[model samples]
Target: MSQDPPRIVIAGAGHAGGSAAAFLRQYGWKGAIVLVGEEPNAPYQRPPLSKAWLKGEATAESLALRPARFYAQQTIELRLGTRVGALDRTARQVTLSDGAVLGYDRLILALGARPRALPLPGAELAGVKALRGIADADALQAALGPGRRLAVIGGGYIGLEVAASARALGAEAVVIEREARVLARVAGHTLSAFLAAQHWAHGVEILTDAQVAAIEGEAGAARAVLLADGRRIPCDAVLVGIGAVPNSELAEAAGLDCAGGIVVDLAARSSDPAIYAIGDCTHRPLPLYGRSGRLESVPNAIEQAKQAAADICGRPPPSPEVPWFWSDQFDLRLQMAGLAFAAHEVVVRGTPDAPGFAVFHLDAEHRVLAVEAVNAPADFMAGRLLVAKQARVPPATLRDTTQPLRGITI
Candidate 1:
């Protein structure tokens, strides 16, 4: 008798979940694939949500990762608007919010993350929102208008992006960050300086180290922002993008090892071999970073999903790939393809003031750790291979604009 095809269930049809399902089908997984999502619509890309979507440059229809017909054609079951509440490992069944149970031989937890709420007065006002979900985006979009004021409650990536978009729409943007510098949590000192300058040059009123005490509004709509320092700034809209918390409630309730996120191995498999996790909700070991930390990037989600899909098909063990990230801000296209923190000294190669240059970060031993380039995709690509091999290059040579970036490799 021939063995039956495996029944696979994937929770959260966002970046990682949807990609894994499509990948499994591409890998020739002749099995039943069920993708469960809490949202009412199909999976979509999130990178452009704050910029293009906010600026009316991209519509909701253009955001779809794959057409609805694609999933149908691939024979992948779509369980949109369905929430998976619990996982029963021993029984190999999942409990949903609607009290239905789904049995699966292999499970993928792509639960993703929930937006971090800014706890302050006026936060519950109608005009205050977070940008983690489609519903949140729609609410914020409806609140935007010409001559309106938009107060952003954080200075992180999402907040900065929103501030830029709001300003472009002719709305007054006031960014209140509790840190001494903008983007303090994610970037190093130099990068933070550059990003802050970028925002300031674009006419964003950035207030670092300012704590918002309350959100002031009338009739449940935001009107102004009150700081702990007793200063109130007039505004019509507010966006809180402090950070995000992993959506690991289902896994934690079911006794999965979770710390900040669902703990997973190199193959993106959770503590329970049968259940694998990926995306922002996972606290798996990242080999490329030379550390184990929760990475909340879209690239991390997609790559981990691809690896998990391969593993589900009984393929060879896949190790974590080189971590890569990018940010599309205004006319600047910043590209980073490896671990930026593994460096001690940074060499600025090319024109620094010209908005197009390559910054090479070297380790204590002077080995190529990472590279940050603006409008220099070629250097970033070559820098990835250099970091992978741990090359030791001369900082002075890297700074010279005359030589091709690749020729200056250590």
Candidate 2:
């Protein structure tokens, strides 16, 4: 109770909420910050929910982004398990489900996203589970055991990770995808091909172009899944990794501009300057991507929250941080710097068959657009700088294993 410095109300205590609170404190904004979340627990890392947590390789304590002491030490008030029922933009207040009305000078919505489910029949069967929150991960984990059969729906990151984890636990894992290949939408053909090989090496059964008709169960317990291809696969549990839709219903109901997600400006402020949204819940126009887009990645969450915090604290904007992301599957550590689309030309600097290699993408102007590195942090770091400076690396040397990737300079 340090005299309640400039009241701020933050909704949805996910990664964005935690990051914004931490940033505010780091920037010396000694204001009263109230982080309100519908979930009973403080903000924890959700990416692990589908990976290590599902495999029981990580625990609730380890998954926590920041400790409970973090908020306590910073004097940031956290109201957990409290749902924000209503928001009045004019009155600058939020009405909690508990019937508590809170007034704020500024508001930040970091509500994040929700997993999308299929509309087919029997979607409510006991085996049907979406991998998003902690509770969902716990339920899925409980179903994993020796000889257990897991039919993982969708061939995205979550499904593949879960499949691997289940296999490690001695469970028969089957991945059924509606697409021709796994992760066709997110990664390029090369990465997808690599991952498919890795999963195959681990003895995971993958069914591509598979359309599941229904989940068959007995006595309200999961038994098997019926596919549209007239194939039935027995299973003890089903993990749906189709995709996620941003949690923008509250903003949409409140009449905020929402396209793919709640539309925000470069500053992370919504159409209404007093209100701001960050993380997966925002379709912010990114100059780096050349247009407005919504990216569902941790890098976007952390960076956008920083921008929102700076704006709230009345500080001049910081430099636009170059976007970066990583994914871990088995022993391969994949890192990406900058954004790359199909138009970009991809050339391998190191041999693809090598234990460690880098794939560099360049534009027509010979400027580095992006780079994907496997177990190559130096290449990743250099790629980050190249994207930031829009630098050029000689085409032959970029692919030459003779020179260190960091030495790749124009």
Candidate 3:
């Protein structure tokens, strides 16, 4: 008699979990695979939630990562609208919210993350929402229309994206940032200033160095936002987009190493060899950054999923990747590569007025560290290659728009 293959169970059916299931099949895994998710919908692309989906340009069905038939045909058991309640490492089993326990020889935790919520008063008021899942987008989209006003509570990518989308839908939008400038924690000052100017030109009001004291409401519905500076901005709705927190509670409860996120190695293996974790829920080492951190991008999730799949299949893992991210606001397309934190200097290529530019962040040794490209795809691609190679280039050469980035020979 032939022996049965090991059972593989994946928690959190998001991008990472879905990818792992597909890749496992691609890599010739004949074992029984089960994917568990809290949401009713199947796996879908999240990048569209704040952009095309919010603007009503894309349908919910269009956002699916794979068609429903794909999952059925692949023989991948999908447990939708089901949550993993607890994990018993000793028994190598996970108990679901329905009180059903599923045994697994190998387990993958792609739990992802949740949007950080504001603890201020009136936070639970109607018309106040955070954009993370499709349900949130649906509620926000229904609230947006002509003559409506939206007050965004953060100046980060999600906040700004929603603000732009609100304006595109003929709604008045305002952005509030506690810091002196927008994107203070992510992009450099140059990119931040350029984005602020663009949003202002598009009729989006941006308030910096501003703090939200409370979200005042009437009859359990959001009415206006009260600022710390004694100013009240009337709005019909509010969006809280400060950031997100990793969904590492399952790993932590299981007694696995977790610190803001589940700690993992390059192979995506957690403390236990029988388990692995990936996506935004993991704090793994980055070779290029020379440190450990959590990356919240689609590319990172896909890459980590592939690594974990390979390790589970006893195949060679792919090479490490340099971190990258992208954002779309109105007509602007921003692509970034590498970590620019602690850079010595920034070199600007192209003019910001032309609405096409790339900012190169270099260390004191002139080594390319990071690149922020706005409407400059060529520069972004070249910069990614250069940053991966740790190539050194003169600041003057980067500042010259006439010089082709490909010819820099980095």
- Highest TM-score scorer: 3
User: Which whole-number lDDT from 0 to 100 does residue 160 have in model 3?
Assistant: 94
Per-residue lDDT over 157-198 for candidate 2, one digit per residue giving the tens place of the 0 to 100 score: 778878887887788899999999998877666667777887
Q: Give the better candidate number (2 or 3) by TM-score.
A: 3
- How does model 1 fare in lDDT? 0.84
Ranking by TM-score: 3, 1, 2
lDDT of each: 0.84, 0.83, 0.93
Q: Candidate 3: count the clashes.
A: 0
* Residue pairs with backbone atoms closer than 3 Å in model 1 (clashes): 121-215, 393-410
In the range 1-410, model 3's lDDT, one tens digit per residue, is 11266789999899999999999989888989999999998899999899999998998689999999998899999999998999999888999998888999889999999999998998999999998889999999999989999999999999999999999999999999999999999999999999999999999999999999999999999999999899999999999999999999989989999978999998899999999999999999888878899999999999999999999888999899989999999999999999986799999999976568999999998999999999999999999999999999999998988888899875
Best by lDDT: 3
- Please give, for residues 1-410, the per-residue lDDT of candidate 1 as tens digits: 11155689999999899999998998779989989999998899888888888888997779998987999899999898888988888889988877888889889999999889877777888888899777877777777768888899998888988888887787778899999998787766666777788888888899998988998999878899999899998998889988999999999998999999999988898989889999999998867556788888888998888889888887876555677788877677877766767568988877666577777888887788777777888888877778777788878777777877677535
User: Candidate 2 regions off by >4 Å?
Assistant: 1-4
Query: In terms of TM-score, how similar is model 1 to the real structure?
Result: 0.95
Candidate 3: residue 224 lDDT (0-100): 96
